[model samples]
Target: MTTTLHVAIDSKTKKAVVFPLVFSGVILLLMMIFGVVMLLGQGKLIELNPNMFYKIMTIHGTGMIGVSALAGSCIIWYFLKQYVPLNTAVFRLNVYLFLVGVAMVLVGIFAYDFAGAWTFLYPLPAQSGGMWGKTGAALYLGGMLVIGTGFLILLLEAARAIIKQYGSLATSLGWPQILGKEKGFGPPPTVVASTMVCIVDIIALITGAALLSMSLINVFVPSFTIDPLLAKNLTYAFGHVFANSIIYMGVIVVYELLPRYTGRPWKSNKIFLIAWNMSTLFTLIVYPHHLLMDFVMPKWMIVMGQVLSYMNGLPVLVVTAFGALMIVYRSGIKWDVASSFLYLSMFGWVIGVVPAIIDATIVINHVMHNTKWVPGHFHIYMGLGACAMILGFMYYLTRLEGGRIDNKLDYLTLWLYILAFLGLTGSFLFSGKSSAPRRWAEHLPEWIPADMVAAFFGTFVTITFLLFLVRFISYSSNIGSKINQSDDIRPSTHG
Candidate 1:
């Protein structure tokens, strides 16, 4: 007789998440192709109208962030469910709202020709300079609100469930442990991470919803207005934090999988709890760094922004990465697709931090903040770090339940992906070093070569990602099939 086991994420929740993950994966492919097309246009290899370029750029940014968040939510929900009771219907509602909102956003962008970009930045939406009209702006902003409403409800529900189980958010955050009132390891890492995410994202989505509501009103009522500075502050505060939260949520997968893989429990100590708490605070405040370019902001706020940006991701990244290395060292863990990607996420996160720190400095930011350097910074972090964690979970799920087998091609594909992604980000950094301005529709001849190089690498990335999605889809059918019995609730040590 043979025995098979799956990760402890329950079967019903796995079935519930299938559509969202599939939707996320398919949309990711579409967005990547849009990214490559943008690179091609910038490279002079294709003829793309300037307006159309910005429009694609708009959807590219919005779609990527939205879907990544959607995918990241799946990871959080899948694991957190093991620790607490989460309503499957609430999770399903988020996907439904996401789809409806995406349709509205599409109509706004393609049908109505609205291309104000994801951040929109206040008056631009109202005063589009004839690039778009009120209806288009309203649809986009309103769609975002609807999507945010769903997430807000979902998060509130998570918080409710967490509080019900753990007594309170602070307890889940391990405040008692950090304060030394309680001893031993803190709450399970999933609880700590989920608590932090629920708190921060609830605040962020509300802030964004308010901003969207105001912007939506301003779209039709020409007399109504918001201070540009306030709008900028709100925009980055919401955008920066919401986007960064994807990685924070996705990292839960690492905390769970690594321990189970190496058979080393990832116990949360006092310091770990403190670090997560600090991250919660810092992530909320660090958006000021993006506004460092605007001198009108209070001097103290500018200083705080830069200071917080330096400290923003350090606490959590340091602990998590160090813990990962310690877990894998001498553990004799098997080298497989899921574990490999989980480990790679650590490298991506740490490396991504270096460039961000550089850009956060007042002097460097003054020089390089507007260059392709900024894009390069986030691409490494969000692309490699957050995306890797999600991909690891995807692969982990398929393998455990579907019995997906790994071949040399899978490893080969991974290698190609690493090198190719490095190649793409390298071109962006080089172009920035050469002083190429970001968000420009056209590039000069000197910059064209770098764009061409980036496009070449981008092509490979899209192809490789297609392979990843195909692999996931092929095995996705077996997801909830093999893990039905009550005994299957336990996690396998490794695949």
Candidate 2:
């Protein structure tokens, strides 16, 4: 006699979360291609209208960050559902709001020639120097506010679910067990990470909302005044925290997914709790590091920023990566695309930190702060680190109902993307060493070759990504058939 065990699957809900993730991923791919084109234009490898070049650059910066956050949040949302009940209606609403926001942003950028960078950095959007009008700036700010509203609702819901189940935010953060050592059972690592990230993100969103609102008001009434320094601090504080939280949100997948591949539980322990708790505190203060170059900034605050930057990097990443290494060591795990990306992302996270730490040093920042190195380091960590994790999760999702991976194509795509990404980033780093500035529309003759090399390799990154994206979509479509098949695998265990 043979018996089969079938686990119930929620295909609709899965698709609900997945639709937004994949939609954002598609936009992300387009932005990468556009970014490569912008590089080519800058390098004089191809002729591009300077206005279009800056427009593409502006949209690319803003879109990539937005998509990365959207994808990461969806991944976190999917996993959080297993432990706590979530409102699918609210999730769907968030998706709709995100799409509307994206549309408005594109209109502002492409249709109206808004060239303010992602930071917008106050005054720059309004002072677009005739490149874009005040209406365009208002549209951009309004779009961000809408996006923030969606995120705020989703985050509040997640907090409500976690707190309802875990009894309190402290318990969700695993503080009761960590502080008192009276652990019976606590929320898992994913929950802890999600809880921590959501708390910080909610606060960041509030600050961002205030900034955008004030900017909108100032655009209409020039009489309204905002202190530049205060605005700068608030801007960096919100932007840095929002960006950093995206990485932590992606790491939640690491805590949840890596263990399954390695056949390890990745239990919520005291060390894990402590590391995340430290993260909650450190993340808020680390934004000051971005303001280190502002001369008017208080000296003590600058010093505090430097200290928090070092402290933040050491705890969460170091602990998570070390545990991941230990879990995989001699585990005889079968290598798959999902697992491979997950493991490699850990390396990217650590390696990217080296340049970041160097830049954070006040001495080095004086020379390197405004150079190509800024984008180089951030792209490595974000493009390779956080983005890699989300891509891995995408692979995981496509395979959830037992879809097969195209091993050869997976290997080819992964290697091609990595090699090209490394070369592109290396060019930026080397150019930064030579004091080449960032955000320039055109490069000098000496700088053109480096930009050309970057553009050349960036083209490969875009191609491989497109290939990966097509394969992911293909596998995702047949999940229902695979799930039904999974229900039929029978086994004989007893006499």
- Predicted model with the maximum TM-score: 1
Tens-digit lDDT string for candidate 1 (8-62): 6667888887779889999998999999999999999999999999999999999
Q: How would you encode candidate 2's per-residue C-alpha lDDT over 284-304 as one tens digit per residue?
A: 888988888898999989998
Clash counts per candidate, in order, are 0, 0
- Where does candidate 2 clash, by residue pair? none
- CA RMSD for every model? 2.6, 3.2
The runs of at least 3 residues in candidate 1 whose Cα sits more than 4 Å from the true structure, single-residue gaps closed, are 1-5, 483-495
lDDT for model 1 comes to: 0.89
